[model samples]
Target: MLILFGWRTTIEQLRMLSLVCGHCHNQAAHHLFRRRTKPTIFFIPLFTISSRYGLQCTFCGVSYDISKADALQLGAHV
Candidate 1:
């Protein structure tokens, strides 16, 4: 018998929302991302190991990690 277990990481662009860019210092379209990591058993996700949020400044081409709540708030279209 053999047992196999591993981890998997996936990066996905959640959405692009209208948000103020700190570097640009103005309202602009920004990209939101969700980086998810999970434990995999037989290539199936067993459970979530970790999750991260990111905000990307399209104007400045910079991206940084941010809190999920904060990112959501800032990502809200207004």
Candidate 2:
């Protein structure tokens, strides 16, 4: 068996891609954090992640994956 560590950030970056809306083809921005009540627990902290790039249209919400590569590309562009 193999064990992998120190990849939490990478996993998160990949997961962010799913939020992208195929219809809109625009990156969704992180709006705000909302508190959610857990079924087992009384209170739980939850966050709403969105994209801050691309155009947001009515078709749907789109969010792009912000991987390390993407960050580097953005830095170079700037």
Candidate 3:
């Protein structure tokens, strides 16, 4: 899965780290090997003033600003 924020990518590269065998008697487990799937991407707009910026996740009620870099280290792409 790839997550893009502006020009920066959260998951730049992906590899199947590991695979586990499914239960032989489980019907749901049989479908686990299905190939095609689509990923859902969520985007939230942030307000920037001067060099300061504020961001909030719409999915979750998490509010943060650029000034709080020590706690939330947000990186900007040049």
Candidate 4:
């Protein structure tokens, strides 16, 4: 029997916030995202193995990692 199992990562946009970009120093909208990694069996995803949050500036395209607490508060409205 052949068994196939691996990990899959998926990124989802949680919400958007108007904030200043750290790199470009421009006031613009930043996209909040959730990145989740899950174990998959035969292309079917199982429980999440790990999760991360990020904020990306729309103007400069620079991305930064955010804390879970901040992500929850910002994503609550969405």
Best-matching candidate per TM-score: 4
| Local distance difference test scores for all models | 0.81, 0.31, 0.29, 0.89
Index of the highest-lDDT prediction: 4
Residues 16-77, model 2: lDDT tens digits: 22234456545554321112222222233233333222222233543343344544443423
Query: Can you rank all candidates by lDDT, best first?
Result: 4, 1, 2, 3
- Model 4 residue 73 distance off true place after TM-score fit, in angstroms: 3.6
Q: Candidate 3: what lDDT?
A: 0.29
lDDT of 1 by residue, 1-78 (tens): 777889999988888887788887878778888888999878888877798988898888878898888867765322
Q: Of models 3 and 4, which has the larger lDDT?
A: 4
Instruction: Give the CA lDDT, 0 to 100, for residue 18 in model 2.
Output: 24
Which lDDT tens digits does candidate 4 get at residues 1-78?
988999999999888899989899999999999889999999999999898899999998999898899988886332
C-alpha RMSD in Å of predicted model 1 compared with the true structure: 3.5
Off by more than 4 A, model 2: 1-59, 76-78
In the range 1-78, model 3's lDDT, one tens digit per residue, is 877553211211111112122322222211111112233335543433223333333333343443534213333231
Compute each candidate's TM-score over C-alphas.
Answer: 0.68, 0.21, 0.21, 0.89
Off by over 4 Å in 1: 18-28, 76-78
